[model samples]
Target: MSTGAAADGGVHDFGCRGGDPAASAVSGRVSGTGEGKVRSLAWNQGTTLLRAWRAGVLPRRKKLLMTNTNAPSSAASLGLLVLRVVVGAIFAAHGAQKIFEYTIPGTIGSFADMGVPLAEIAAPVVAFVELIGGILLILGLLTRPVGIVLAIDMAVALILVHLPAGLWVGDGGYEFVAVLGVAALALALTGAGRFSVDGAVLRGRAPAWLS
Candidate 1:
């Protein structure tokens, strides 16, 4: 025969062929007393504890998961801001050198030497675009359109001046122009990010093209 203790502290016997009188008496006493009620109360308390633990732990886990996911996006916004500012500064410096230091006539002469078509007209136009666009880029004003214009300008310089020299900038190659062009293209596609004037002005309600 196998014997086991019940939740009510009663002993039960299995395989009692003759139906053991002692086991039957103990079962009747437990059922008639307050032990069964005490067991029910303990079971309810255990169930309540389990439910409370789940309620407390689940929200905490969800919050931790959300924090981990959001961290990378915050870092990306900062990265984009850094990229925009640095590239804008470089373009601005180059533009200032061409317009102020080199002089328009000198720039035209250089363009002519480089075999640029319509050097006289193209020289002033390129200089103006670079100077004004660079300033606008730094201010994050009209970012996407300005980025497109700068990208095209760099692409032209690459095709006409740098491509023939090869890939290394030290050898007068297209490396610098290619990098500038790709950066401009990226800006054109991504816009200025949350740190930009565009973001401040738009306030997350901008049109698709503007962004």
Candidate 2:
């Protein structure tokens, strides 16, 4: 973390505007301190900013925005709640359809027809996992685990039943499962957000990976 200005030739005006007061003032002061440090000072409207870097580093105007460090906004939580409700309901409905409407025997027959391996074993597991996971998701409890399981469930459906049909859902393609998988994976990674039961209990006290 060395600190000093760059050499004269190192300074470049990034402001675009000609004769900018801040750029003009800093022009003459740019000079290397011979300690492998670089710094820049810019001022406008009686405000001053000084930044330093080492190891040939320089200031940057563009930065990656992949992370969100600020506290979750209420609107964001609301959005998460909506997403959870809708997606969870869909999953739960599918699960219920398998167990009640189709029945275990029927699901097994369908799985067998689709050439799914171990249809006898997988039928019940997939049904209960979706039902339980979907309920958990709706309640915002154990969301991450539920999300992962559901995502995997969707992935298996894609591979076994949907992928070979092409990209359109009308053709029985994987598009629907793919969307559900990504959505579930997103929930797994993001957790239930501030509107969830996890938020009410964890409150920053839970382990990072779990939270």
Write down the lDDT of every candidate, Cα atoms only.
0.83, 0.78
Worst 10 residues of 2 by lDDT: 55-64
lDDT of 2 by residue, 42-123 (tens): 2332233333333222333212222344456788878888888888888988889999999999999999999999999999
Best by lDDT: 1
lDDT of 1 at 9: 95
190 Cα displacement, candidate 1 (Å): 0.8
* TM-score between model 1 and native: 0.64
In terms of lDDT, model 1 sits at 0.83
Off by over 4 Å in 1: 1-72, 203-206
**In candidate 1, what are the lDDT values of residues 1-211, reduced to their tens digit?**
6677889796766434467867766766776577779988999999987887777975787889997764336567677688788888888888888899999999999999999999999998999888888887787777898899999999999999989999999998999988888998898888877677886796457774565
Model 1 clash count equals 0
TM per candidate comes to 0.64, 0.67
RMSD in Å for all candidates: 9.6, 12.1
